[model samples]
Every structure is written in structure tokens, then in C-alpha cells.
Target: MIVAFDFILLLFVIICAIAAISVKDLLSAVYILGAYSFFMCLLWAEMGAVDVAFTEASVSAGIGTVLLIAAVSKTKRRSKD
Candidate 1:
């Protein structure tokens, strides 16, 4: 069961990463990147790295997301040049 859960989480992380890269909308891509970080944190917890997971969740999913969003906000929603 634990292995199965890890597999699922891994799959979810991969999908989110792909979506983050392929999405045309900058905001949606950033949100997906944040989701990828959140899943990575969950995967870390499942692997018994609680402290690392905590840091990943707080830094990646929290601060990283905020910074990405702020950067995106400074640019146009769609690119023309």
C-alpha cells in the first residue's frame, strides 16, 4: 500500500510538472508549478523525510509560488514579442 501510494504521488508530480511546462497561460503554469512542489513535499513525507518535506512545503509551495506569481504579474498575460 505504501509503495502504491508513492507510485501515485510520483505520477501526479510528473503530470503537474508537464502541465507546468506546457501550459500557455503564465498564471496557470505557475499554479501548476506550485502544485508540483506540493506533491513533492507529500512524496518526501511518504518517504519518511518529514523535516525535508516540511521545508519543501514551506519554501517551494509557499515562498517559491509567491515569487513566481509576482514575477508573472510583472509581465503581460500573453506574449506577443
Candidate 2:
């Protein structure tokens, strides 16, 4: 059961990664990257790396996402294509 959950989590992470890269909108991509970071945190926690997971959550998913969004807000929101 745990392995199944891990497999699903990994699949979602891969999907989120692809979506983050493929999205044209900068803000949307940042949000998707944040989601990817969150999923990574979950994966780490599941693997017993609690410290790494918490760091990923607080730094990557939290402050990192906020900073990316703020940076995007200061620039153009759309892509040239």
C-alpha cells in the first residue's frame, strides 16, 4: 500500500514537473513549480527524511514560491509566443 502511494506521488510529481515547464504563463509556471516542490516534500517525508521535507516545504514551497511570484509580478506575465 505504501509503495502504491509512493508510485502515485512520484507520477504526480512528474506530471507537475512537465506542466510547470510546458506552461507559457510565468505565474502559472511558478505556481506549478510550487506544487512540484510540495509534492517533493511529501515524497521526502514519506521516505523518512523529515528534515529535508520540512526544509523543502518552508524554503522551496513557501518562501521560494512567494519570491518567484513577486518577481513575476514585477515583470511581464505572458510569453512572447
Highest-TM-score candidate: 2
lDDT of each: 0.90, 0.94
**Residue 10 error, candidate 2, Å:** 0.5
Candidate 1, 36-81: lDDT as tens digits: 9999999999999999999999998999999988988997776432
TM-score of each: 0.92, 0.93
**Model 2 lDDT at residue 7:** 99
* Candidate 2 residue-wise lDDT, 1-81, digit = tens: 289889999999999999998899989999999999999999999999999999999999999999999999999999864
Model 2 segments beyond 4 Å from truth? none
